[model samples]
Target: MQFKPVVALVGRPNVGKSTLFNRLTRSRNALVADYSGLTRDRHYGEGRVGTYPFLVIDTGGFEPVVKSGILKEMARQTEQAIAESDVVIFLVDARAGVNAHDHEIATMLRRAGPKIILAVNKAEGMNKVQATAEFHELGLGEPVPISSAHGDGVADLIENALASLVNPVVESSEETSMTEMDEEALEQALATEEGEEVSQELFTDHRIKLAIVGRPNVGKSTLINTLIGEQRVIAFDMPGTTRDAIEIEFEQGDKKYTIIDTAGLRKRGKVFESIEKFSVIKTLQAIEACNVVVLVLDAQSEISEQDAHIAGFILESGRALVVAINKWDGLDQDKRDWIIREFERKMRFLSFAKIHYISALKGQGVKALLKSVNEAHAAAFRKLATPKLTRELRAAVEQQPPPRKGIFRPKMRYAHQGGQNPPLVIIHGNALDAINDSYKRYLESRFRKVFKLEGTPMRIEFKSSTNPYKDSEK
Candidate 1:
């Protein structure tokens, strides 16, 4: 399989590597921070510079002589990044000039020897040339002057990096993902006669894009790893270990899945560093991209404000939802009862979603979670014929008729399914705005029950199709 050429950004702390990464990818996949050593892991994203398309890996800021703690781990990770990359962009702060840390990294890069492109960042406008002139002394050749934050001279840096790629690998995210054929289907396909075109309609990727989201250290990554049945993501005890939204695909039966593992979200006041702020941005974006979201909560802890905030976000996004309570293995009956009660009190707005108690560490109760996810996704795609929808509407009205607004008894004309994925039902009437909340909710519940839309949200829109001929007659 052809893999895209990898370009890595290597430099000392606080030198705009993540900013450069975001700019290159045209996405905020990598968290950018003003403080040093905020990035801890390798974040890979696809980007193009003019004619060159490549995979960019953003590593934690390289600290030369660190021996232990998170910094040491970061240094080790950066080294691994260099070894894997085809081209390395050594970003240095032009304002600060080249320091001992820069020399240390440059020496290592020279010995390792990838296509070294020196990027002198924070150099913009008329002073760009003068600021970059000193970097030539590092013996790496000309330093491409640019401002990562302002998009200055970034194109030249990309062009220099592109010169090294001989046969560029053009691969999509799906191709890179781990996709397996369903066992029974795979066996059937292999048994087909040679050159006889076996129909591939069975292998079609009707995969649901499910995103797992929650607060820090809530086992988001662990839950994802369990769901995919692989250690596809780094699950650590440390908070903020996952810095980007990572996508991994796998197949079960005929259902393909692209599961998105997002960085943990924390409340704004607690988010001090710039990196943490960026991580929150990445999480929100992941929710927007997904078809269904699994909001993981720590069963051991009480439901905090952040939990409610995250749940509210999913409801607002209009995505199908499954609330998975993680770390359920050790919880006692009392704790479980409390957890269930907490969800009930907080998530009344999202009563449509099904909740699953799961132990991701032990792989318990996950199969049921998958089942709920499937049902929810299928419901989102549900389409109702107009005649059937109208009948259902009439039935609903007869059961609980619309309330009179002063003198006028609103006439219900027609009903139709406008869209799916939180199935949208449009009911045309004279004064839909006057439809009381209780009646509206009653209809929503009735429709969900009739359509069997469990573990998925449903929306009912009251559209007023006023009769124009009534006023003309008067």
Candidate 2:
């Protein structure tokens, strides 16, 4: 893997660090709102200037003098980000001028080793003299005036940031040469194989992107730390410790996977906090982006409506799912059975997903859980042959034919795969519009059973054949 220089965005609460992050990364991945401390965790994103790629770390607000509580934790996270960064873009509010918190943060950054660039944000209309006047007192260096929201002076800011890096980005020609060498090596290997096909597997990104999601304090971050075997993400003992969807890439056995540690999702009615609302949106997006989702459920607590809602969203999105009953080590056999029963009663609709009892803290049943995840990923992308699909459709119809709807029975003819990743089987027939949801579900079950499509939700689509003669007569 090539090294991408890390750029850490550091500043006080509501100083436009996230806006600058979004500007540099060209993504709204970091939640942006008109509030102090909307971002709590360090969110990493990839940014590029021309052909040079660099990693941007969007950190929480820096309160260096904070002693206790979440602010202190956020300060620690920001400090860690600074330590890991190649360049630190210490952002300041041009509109707000230099405050006590800004001085405190600047004092801390001056002692740090990274290349610090003091940026005066929200300076779109201000001249260089006005923008630099207030910030010069901090004494980091010349202030780069920028408007993070309006994209003013951001390009120059990034260019200047990258230029200060120790290992400068390699030229495009050198990068191209390296890519050409890789392609040449691949071609030589394919030539040596002699009649064997190796094109599809070689060109594609085979990493399984798995999203681990659940309610607040359900060991989602704990599970991620256990899987990665490191404390890459802060697994603090708090309800909302994780507020960003942190993606960590790791390998298990021979398989490569990118596990997303998403923020806990609370019920919409209960989420009054603006930051939590943004966290909820980020969690949903993580589910949509990943190949499979590991829905972590609290083994001790009763299955709530919120859990079902999250599960329902996953099903609606048609993503492959695996239910992980977390913190199983703490629960006795009887309690475990009770929790399982409750889960079954509440989330019976998610019968297709594989369930596992695991202690994310102790690493119990983790291997089995990942195995199910791999199986689910495979099932989601599994190809269905048209002839086989048609045959299965005929067999299903023979076993249980559709009931008549006002003298018109559904005449199901054949089926073919319309799409994959929550595989869609489109059935062509007459009076197909009469086929109800129940019959459609029955067909889905049959196809699933025949194809062994476990850990994935399958859809059965009905396409009614139109009569050309009826149109002509009309």
Candidate 3:
């Protein structure tokens, strides 16, 4: 399959690379801030310039690292992104003018073998423009003066950049003729599994879409890497290492799964100060799309309010969940038990989910995790027969009668499993919303018990239905 072009953004610290990223992509996908080193890893987002679709990579701003450490790691990631890009948007702070570090980064970019576009950012007014003149000394080309914050001179830069691409654009009629041809090509590509011939469609028929979610630095990327047995997603020691929701598809023991590594969720109050707010939105989107969610938790840290909030989203979304206590290698037995018990008690709504202790760094417990995932996926799609469902409904009704408000007795007529894959059960009833929380919990408990659906989330929709003729006669 043909892939889109990649554009990498590189600049000195606090030079507005992130800001320029947000402007170019027309998305706040990258974290932007006033401080230096806010972005510590390479964040990828899709961008379209005119009709040219390209992948925009927002790299951490360069910090002149004299020695090997996290800063060196950050620089390496930036260099890697620049190396892979089709075009590099080399940003320079118009306000700061040309500095020693700017020169250093420009020298590196010149050797990277990508088409480099010089963007002099923070050029808000005349003084900024006058200051941008010093950037000519870097010797790449003419600096495209732009104010990423104010959205100035961006469109012209993109238009110019796309015009320089190597590919020739086909005419509209030619493109339309190629549509049927492309479908046949795509079908052929899908028939082969990465160069191996497959008789049946491995992933096309049945696939598990799972999202790995947790707070920052909870080893979400590491878990994905372990599951896929490769470095599909970049992992680092720093918090918020992952800034984009990256989807990768792979098969394990013949079961195909699509794993999405999401950005960590921070407290909404704290997010105002942190630049990773965009990442949080991406995580929420991932949660909404996935069939099952694997909530990764740092085994060392106490369960915080942010963790609970993230769990609440999964519960409300009504997706099958698996709580992965990551970093289990370092934890003592006592600590491990305490954390498991606490997580269970605090996240009572998610108590049905199975908890597994795993060390994504060491590749421990990943096999069992995958097995549980397969089971949960099957349970999510498990269909109950009408007779069986009615029996369970009777048991539930007998255990706890619907709430009585003074004189009236609430009645539930019938219930049926309407669908599978997050297994929705529709209950036809009278004054459904009036059913108390306690009775709702009882019904949920009874459903779980009858089905033995240990780690799957079940939905009970209360549909208040009555005879249409009776209402019309009234």
Candidate 4:
């Protein structure tokens, strides 16, 4: 496997590092905002500039002097991204001019330098050339004036960055590791257990793709860090520390998994920033792309409408779901009891989703949460034979037949499994269009109960069976 040259986008917060990142990758994966330090982790994305394919790492704002708290951790992550990268696009805000923090970051990058490409972002038109004059004091090189927002001079910056990596490159060791891991992954095929044998097909053929999602500040990033046993993402006290959908691949006990950490979503009224609006769309896209979605909720408070909205979207997308209540290590028994009662009253619709109370900070109850994630993935991909599906549909209709609509009684003639991954089933019948939402819900419930699809979504499609003789008659 050939390794793409890794390029690190380093700068202070809100300096258009993420904006430049989005421009380069052609993806709004990173969250962008006017607020400082919105991005607290190193987000990785793949991009190409004029056929030059490369990897890009968007690091959080680089505050060089912070010695304590989350800023220190952010500094550490940014430095690590720089160290691993072959080239660094040192982004600066032309609008802000040469600030103290920018100078500090410049000094740090100069000392621990890679091939640095100085980019003066937000500099457009005639001001572009003059906007880079102040950055000359940083002593990196001639600043590449570019507008990340409008794609002005961005391609030139990328071209220069890739040009620096053309010659004198070392062979990567990632290919060797991949070869060894692939061999090991294949060796576990059809391995025998203590008594019963577990098929390695679960590990080889399909790896669980899980997404961690919830409202802002609900420990979604923390839970992913705990599960992966690494601080791969920046988890901070800030309400929206994570701004992008970060995907990390790893293996546990011979089983492969790709976990996605998405931006926390707030209600539309509260969401004011254009950047956050983009983040919301990315989170929704992530939910649709994943096999399972872990809906993390704050255990300290009752479930809110934001949680319900997020859940409704997940169920509507027909993705597997796991409800994880975080911050469960502390609190009195009464609060726990209240949470249960609140769920029973407000969230009974999610009875199909397995719920776990966990402390993401301390990694409590996380293993069981992952077990549920795996089970839910399997349930979502379950395939039912034609005969079995027809029988189950007949049983479901017998229990609660669709009520007569005025003069006509909707009939469920037969059913068959149309697809898997949220098991889509097609129900053929006469007057199926008359069946209302209530009947659809009833059939969905029956499908879950009969097929044992406990923690995943199931979809039902109604179709009016066509008559073959109609073409000749017409």
Using lDDT, give the best candidate's number: 2
Model 3: clashing residue pairs?
none
Better of 1 and 3 by TM-score: 1
Model 4, 77-147: lDDT tens digits are: 67766765678899888888898998888888778757888988888864756888888998888998889
In candidate 3, which residue ranges exceed 4 Å CA deviation?
A: 1-205, 230-245, 263-278, 431-434, 467-474
| lDDT of every predicted structure (CA atoms) | 0.72, 0.75, 0.69, 0.72
| lDDT: the better of candidates 1 and 2 | 2
Better of 2 and 3 by TM-score: 2
How many steric overlaps does candidate 1 have?
1
Candidate 1 colliding pairs: 380-421
Query: Tens-digit lDDT track for model 3 on 9-60?
Result: 8887898888877777776544221223433556665564455655577877
Higher lDDT: candidate 2 or 3?
Answer: 2
State every prediction's TM-score relative to the real structure: 0.54, 0.54, 0.52, 0.52
lDDT of 1 at 349: 79
C-alpha lDDT (0 to 100) for residue 45 of candidate 3: 58
Question: Model 2: residues >4 Å from true position, as ranges?
Answer: 1-205, 230-245, 263-278
Ranking 3 against 4 by lDDT, winner: 4
- Model 4 local distance difference test score: 0.72
